[model samples]
Target chain A: MKKHNYSAGPCILPQEVFEKSAQAILDFNNSGLSILEISHRSKDFVAVMDEARALVLELLNLEGKGYEVLFLGGGASLEFLMVPYNLMKVNGKAAYLDTGTWASGAIKEAKHFGETVVVASSKPENYNHIPKGYTIPSDADYFHCTSNNTIFGTQMKSFPETNIPLVCDMSSDIFSRVLDFSKFDLIYAGAQKNMGPAGATLVVVKTEILGKTGRTIPSMLDYQQHVSKESMYNTPPVFPVYASLLTLQWLKKLGGIAAIEKINDAKANLLYSEIDRNPLFKGTVAKEDRSNMNVTFLLNDEAHQEKFDSMWKAAGISGLAGHRSVGGYRASMYNALPLESVQVLVDVMQELEKNS
Target chain B: MKKHNYSAGPCILPQEVFEKSAQAILDFNNSGLSILEISHRSKDFVAVMDEARALVLELLNLEGKGYEVLFLGGGASLEFLMVPYNLMKVNGKAAYLDTGTWASGAIKEAKHFGETVVVASSKPENYNHIPKGYTIPSDADYFHCTSNNTIFGTQMKSFPETNIPLVCDMSSDIFSRVLDFSKFDLIYAGAQKNMGPAGATLVVVKTEILGKTGRTIPSMLDYQQHVSKESMYNTPPVFPVYASLLTLQWLKKLGGIAAIEKINDAKANLLYSEIDRNPLFKGTVAKEDRSNMNVTFLLNDEAHQEKFDSMWKAAGISGLAGHRSVGGYRASMYNALPLESVQVLVDVMQELEKNS
Candidate 1:
């Protein structure tokens, strides 16, 4: 059976990326040493690091724009702590918009460093939509938000325009679509979802925005030190960075973010349309806020749930079960997810409606 | 020519371990999903994590000994800061032995959280020998030491018997020897030298020693919280952990640390004998303090440098160049390095002597 992977993350990646990464692990750049065993400072692995950093800037179209890129270990969960450790001042406040689980995690970490005010939240609605029309406080040292919520299947369509530094966690939606990269002072993403694998976190920060936080930041969490060291402050997570480089290369070869966004939209539209047109199923999030990356839905009747799940399983679908909190289905269509997989889900939904 | 990897780390691993890890990356446990794409919570990976943790305790003979093992990202450098953040209480003091570069790094980070007293240091002699005849302060909250110095090629032959909590960084010599596991409250090793790769840090902490610091630690850096969460406090460096599991399995099959320690001793002896007897080369560190893992030596004459360098390169030897600070050759004989490779290095030295 042809497998259709919808695992949230570490999720789908281009097949070519997998093949290349596998080969590198066996014999990195023909060095006769597995990528698993070579030094990160070795010429071959250094080239992997250099190319990965360059391609990130190239894909974002932020080259030569005073934005520095870093690949660090410890995922976005660590970034939740690091962002405020290096940015939020000792006595100042940072404003956050709580949209989902990840945003709430970020807020919790930030409060440990300084005062944090939640400007707005969609938690009352179970985070079914991105919060909007919230006022940004000028006195806040920075305005932080999560650009996409993987669990709730909602994405922020527009970012808040503010004079305060803007820090966004683009973990689930990075490289899936085009975005105005210049508007934010800092952006970070864990590479598990849209990028490559689970290990390295991609951090992009404007140099000018750093060094203003008066607290003494640990070297590992200090943004300025990492930027100065070119992300070689310490031995990095080498394999994941190499895999990310391959994925970035795939994205660039496929004409970058602009080309992928069109396909992503088509995939989301096809799945959502099937849910709405078929009487058996209903889309979960609001129409305007539906995520192009993760399409979430549910059956109209409880009796059809087991039948629909088995049908998808028999059709070779995996990881479609929704988060425990949401309790339905979530088909994550990352950058490498083909339109055919989305069609397979749509076909399953149609067959279920007719048969039931 | 068969290649001999002598890079400090990410260094080398057993051939079977590499093959198994490579296959896992391509198709993990016949799941049709690349290890790179599988969720950390998946049964396959959870098994890998569980087995890896179990093997660590088993090898150390610490099973059911109240010690908790964790695999985390950010390498040993991050642990430098994390150790102090979680263990050093406000206004308390920690005693550290400054053996070499990494120990100094740990001392630097520890001072930021609490008072750090360097009870003894070998810096006066360019860190070529481990300092002795110094006393660890009984009033200190803890006594910290680095077991092996990769750059300086020094190893502590004995540990301080102190009532204070003992913490040791065993990055270079972990799993290569047998030690009294009960003597230390915490033992942390970066997985690069004698283990697997460069991302994950192996932490074994006695559960009772935690939660005494009375400082607010960021969740990512808090040892007690990580223990409660079972090291999935966040998405771990999944690939590295998987590879480490395979390596640990390889170690166990080869009879664990006691068995590897014998091979490691043989390899170090073979290499050191050549360096001492050849007359063309000389060992660097003091005899008693010489590391069984890393053997540092220097050419007697600068004039034979090119001839000896090309001779080893032609023999398929790699990473024999010493650290810049030491300005000599370092043959790191980790457990994965076979005796035949050490014989090859010795043969090359003999050939160079004959040619010179």
Candidate 2:
């Protein structure tokens, strides 16, 4: 049976890209060398790094604004501490939007480095919706936001225009839509979602935003350290970076960001419409601010959850269970997910509705 | 053309292993999900973590010992700082043998934490030979050594048999030889060389030696944290771990470490014997301390250097240049390099000699 993946992360990848990537790992473009064995400094590996970084800049349509593309170790959890450590000015506070678990996790790490002001939070409502009408502090070092909340299934459709520099943790929805790179000084994401594997963290930071922090930070935690060394500050995670590079190539070949975003939006729409029509499934997130990446929903009767799960598994739909914190279903519709898969999921929901 | 990969670290991997690893990155075990998309808590990833760790322990032949095997982020450079921070106590000294750049790096990072004693150094001879007659300190926290100096190409043939907790940075020559691992309390290696990719670091440490140092270390930096978290402390380098696991399975299927060591010796013998018999070549490291993993040699006629380099590159051989610190030739015969590749290298050396 052909399996359709709905995993929240470590998510789906295009088959064409996957095949080429697999070949490289095996024989590495007829070099008869595994990509895993090459040194980061070698001309071959250097080309991989150079092309990957170049492709990232090309993908975002940002061609030379002094922004660096780095594939670094440690996930977004590390970035939580890093962003503030590098960009937050001396004695200055950074404002953050607390939309979900990851957003709050970022806030927690940022506070340890400098003063973090929560400009907006959905915590009182259990993070199901994005909080609005929150003041953006002009004195703040940067306003941070989680663009797509993976767990809560909410997204910032339009970013807030803050006087201060904008820093967004676009971990879950990067490259899933047409990004406005000029509005934000920096954007970073864990590659597990909408990218490649989990080892590498994709960091895109405007050079002007750096060197503001006066605090003496460790080398690994410093963003400028990575940019200067070209993300080979130490030996990089080569295989993951290669995988991501392949993904960027795949995305580019599929007609850049605009074309993919159309496909992604269509996929998300189908799933969302299904959840709305089916009484057994009630969408968990607010209608206005629902995520186009992760669609979180719950059954009208919780006891039917087991049957629903088993049926989906039997139908070869995997990783549909929502986060336990918001128990039900979450069908992640990233760039790589085919619309047909979403349709399959919708058909299953309809069958359950008819039976009920 | 079958490319002969002589590049040091990240140089080559088995084609089959790379293929398998790349497939997993797309949809692990054909489960129709990117391995990166899956939760670390999932049974699949947990099995990966366990099998990789188990193989390392099994390869080292320490199945029932007090040692704990951990796959952590940050390369051996981080481990250089970590080893002292975890093992060196306030006012407690550790003995170190400085052979080359990596050993010197370890020594410098150690000084930042606690007392350090330099037992012996080969730097006076420009790292062409391993230092000997080092008096191992008894009351010291531990005696540290780099098992094989990657650049200088010198290895410690006989480990110090002292009862004290003997620690070694085996980042270069780990698994290249069969050894009694019980002799050392801690052994670590970066996966770029003999292991798999560049992101993951393998640490085999004795459980009894920890907690003696009273210094407060960060959770991620502490070895105990990885042990307790089962190396998933901070969303580990999933792609790298999977690649490493594939390599491990390949190693086990090839009759484990013992069988590979025999082949390793044969490859080393083939290269060194040519260097010894040929009038055009000369081995740099002392005969007794010659590294079986990385063979460093130089031509007697320095004039052949440029031609030699050109010939190797033209013949599709890569990364044969010696370290900048040592101007010669280094053929790093890591585990992934087939015996045929070594034979090809020897044939090239012979051809170069004949033409000259």
Candidate 3:
């Protein structure tokens, strides 16, 4: 069966990326050495690291614009702590808009370093929508927000333009759309969602914004050290970086982020239209705030739950189950997901309605 | 030509483990989802996590011995900081043994968290031997040491029997030999060498020894949180963990660490014998403290450098060039390296002698 993978993270990558990565694991660049075993400092693997860092900037249209990209280990969860450790200073305050679980996580870590103010939060309504009308305090060291919420399936349609240094965690929706690259002072994403695998976290930081945090930062968590060493201050997560490079290559070959956004929009629209039209289902988040990457929905009639799950399983669907926090189905339409897969899901929804 | 990989870390894995891990990356356990895409919370990957953790304890004979195993990201470099963060309290002191680069790295990080005492060091002799007769301070929070110095090619043949907690960075020599697991309160090994790949760090900590630091450890660095969550405090490096599980399975199938130790010893003996006998080469580390995993040597005469380098390259040897700091050669013989490969390297040395 051809499986339609909708996993929230460690999520689907382009099949070509998968094939190429697998081949590299056997014989990377005809070196007769597995990518799994080659030294990160080796010329071939170093080229991979260089290409991955370069492509991240190129795809974001931020090339040579003073934005440095670092491929680091520990995923976005660690980034939650590292961001504040490196940027938030002693006695300084940072503003955070808590849209979902990840945002709250970031806020929690930021508080450990200094003062953090939650300007607004959607947690009051179970995080079903992106919080709006939040005012960034001029005194805040930086303003942080999660661009997309994977668990609740809400995405910010518009970002706040502020003089305060803007930081965004784009873990779930990075590379799935085109956005202004120059506005944010810093952006980070775990590659598992739209980029590549789970080990490497992609960090794009404006070099000027770093080293201002008066507090001493641990070497491993310091952005300045990582950027200065080009993400090789220590042995990096070599295989994940290589896999991300291959995925970035695939994204570039497919015309970069701009081209993927159109397909992503179509996939989101196709599945959302069925949810609105079918009597058996309803969309989870507010219509305008719906995530183009993760489409979440719930069955209107609880009795049809088992039947609907079986139907999707029979259709070779995988990872459609929603998070425990939000009990429903979530179809994660990352950049690599085909529109035909969304059509198949829409057909399953229509079939469920007809059966009822 | 088949490559003989001796690159220290992101180093060699068993061929069977490689095949299985590569296949899983395509379609993990017939779930029709790539291992790269599967959720860490999924039953299949959870099993991989559980089995890998269990095997660590099993191989070390520490199962049900009040120890918990965690698979984390950022490799040993991150652990260099984390070890002190979670264990060293503010105003407290920790004792350290400065063996080589990684130990010195660990010492540098530990100093940021609290006062760190270098109880002993081998740096005076260019780290050519593991320091002996060092007494650890009982007043210290913990005594830290690197079990194997990868760059200097020195291994500790004995461990301190002290009342103070002992923490070891066994990045290079883990799973290559049997050790007294109960004597140490904490043991960490980066999975790139003798384990799997270059992403996850394996931490085995005695549960009762945590939470005494009195400082708030970041959740990501806190061992308690990782133990409670079973190493899924966040989306772990899933692919690396899975690959590690496959390697552990391979290790277990080959009669665990004890059996591999014999082979590792044989391979080291075979290579070191040639290094000692060949007039053109001489071992760098002291004979008594020379590592069984990494055998460091230098050309007796600098004139033979190009000839020796080309000879190894022609014999399909990779990663034989030593670390720049050492300026010689390092042949890392991990568990997966066959004795036959060492013999091949030995033959190359003999051929160099004949050519001279």
Candidate 4:
């Protein structure tokens, strides 16, 4: 009984990924060795690393655009420090758009490097919507933003136009929708959300944006060092990287991101429509800025809480409870979550309204 | 058939770990979810983390000694920078013993913080032996050493007596030998060897030694932050951590570190004895400093290289090729490798001697 898994990240992956990844652990490529035991420098693993890197570029349409992909460990949290270490020059200021907790975390790390300016923040309103109409300073080292806020259930529908090295952390919403990815000079995502599992992070950066920071960066934090070594700067997170490749291959087989985007849109529309029509439920964030990935909403009446909880649990719904900050139900419909699963939740929502 | 895995780090783990890890990916603990899909904050995973951390201290005989365990990402390479950031004070110096490639790498990262003094180095002799009788600066922030050099096949048989904080990088040989666990203030190891898979790193630190550097470390790099949150400061490398827990559990079932040390010693003795007795083979490193974990040796003549290579391959010996820096064969017998595998290798060496 594999329930409808809506875990925000480390969420649902394609069933095929689960099967193949398990098989690899037992015996990788029939090499008579577990994937965990093989050397990172082995020809078999080198091919996995190379193919995964190339697939990232091919899917993002950045293959010939001077973009290089790196699969790193430490999740997006480490990227907060690495981004500032590799991009913020000595005594240079960085501009950040404060959307949510993760965005503020990035700002905090950048402040350690130099001046970190918050252009505008929706924090006062509890980050229910993306802050807009903020002016970007051209003198800043780079402009940083997070594409989607997983906890707050708000997302940036449009990115601001900026010339000075546009950077984004797409940890929760990468590959969920189609975007002109080359517009940003740098992009990083923790693979847990929509890509793969929880160990590896995907970093796609334009090499030209690096090496100008002027600060003496440590080798592990320096993007150029990782680029030169082809992400083998240290022994990579082997199992995570291999599993991520399996998920990426599954996406490609289903016609890449463009095809999955349609399925995702359908899932989002079905659930959002039910939230809007049902009398017992109410949506949580601003309607226009609602995340297509994480749909946060609440039961309108407190008396219905226990009943609604039991109903969803009985209907095989898991991870529907919202984050502590947002106090409600959040259905995280990532790329691997099927439309049928979303409909099951909608039916449960409709049943609650009728019984009330 | 499972081959005799001799690859360096990211080397062999218990076969039980492999079977259980593969099963967890499909359905973890009958939770109707894959281990790869479960939330790290969930009760099931929190139990896993708590048990794993407790097991590390118990195995090291550091329990109830104010030692805290952390499973982090970025490998031991990231620790190169973090060790300096968390310990070195403003304008303070640190002393390091350069034993091999990894030891030198740690020294390189420490130079960026402040003055870094290399008390001794065996680089001139190509790291064939450990540097001895180095004086530690009492005024230095800390003293660092690597317990085993994986690439050069040399290890420190005895540690230095120092008043300063003693730190060790035990990436290649952790959990494979019994040590005076209370002697060192801090120990770190990448989990690729003798533990589990790659991605997660194990850090055991005496908490009292922290926060004296007076440096405002980044939240991710701060050991205090991880300790406070109980290693859940951020999303951890979930799969790697889980697999490591499995390996640790396997070790405890086989009577813990004291038991594994005897088996590890036996394997090393059987293989090294053959290397010394075989006319066609010679050990590469100094006799006394040879590592019990990684056994490096070479063919006495280039003519025998082809026949010996074929013999080992036919016997299902994998990853016997030495590192490029040490041009010979390296037989890494970690905790999981059996004495039977070493016997198989010794038999092949004797057969090669007979043919020659």
In terms of lDDT, which candidate is strongest? 4
Runs in model 3 with CA error above 4 Å? none
* Poorly placed runs, candidate 4 (over 4 Å): none
The A-chain TM-scores of all the candidates are: 0.99, 0.97, 0.99, 0.99
Model 4 per-residue lDDT tens digits across residues B74-142: 999999999999999999999999999999999999999999999999999999999887799999999
Clash list (residue pairs), candidate 4: none
lDDT tens readout by residue for model 3, A18-134: 789888888888888888998888899888889999999999999888999999998898988988888887888899999999999998888788899999998989999987887
Top candidate on DockQ is: 4
Candidate 4's fnat? 0.82
**Alpha-carbon lDDT, every model:** 0.89, 0.84, 0.90, 0.94
Report the lDDT tens digits of candidate 4 across residue range A117-136: 99999999999999889999
Better of 2 and 3 by TM-score: 3
Per-residue lDDT over B1-356 for candidate 2, one digit per residue giving the tens place of the 0 to 100 score: 65788877876777777667767755677666666567776789989999999999998999899989988776777788789878988778888989898898889878877778999998988887888777888889999999898888899898876867899999888887888998989999888888888888899999899988887665556788778887887778887888788888888899988888999999999999999998899999899999988999999999998888888888788879888878788999888889988888888889988998
DockQ of each: 0.73, 0.52, 0.82, 0.88
Candidate 4: TM-score of chain A is 0.99
lDDT accuracy of residue B265 in candidate 3: 84
TM-score against truth, every candidate: 0.99, 0.91, 0.99, 0.99
Candidate 2 residue-wise lDDT, A56-158, digit = tens: 8998988888788888876777687778878887788989999999888888777766788998889888898988888998988899999999988999999
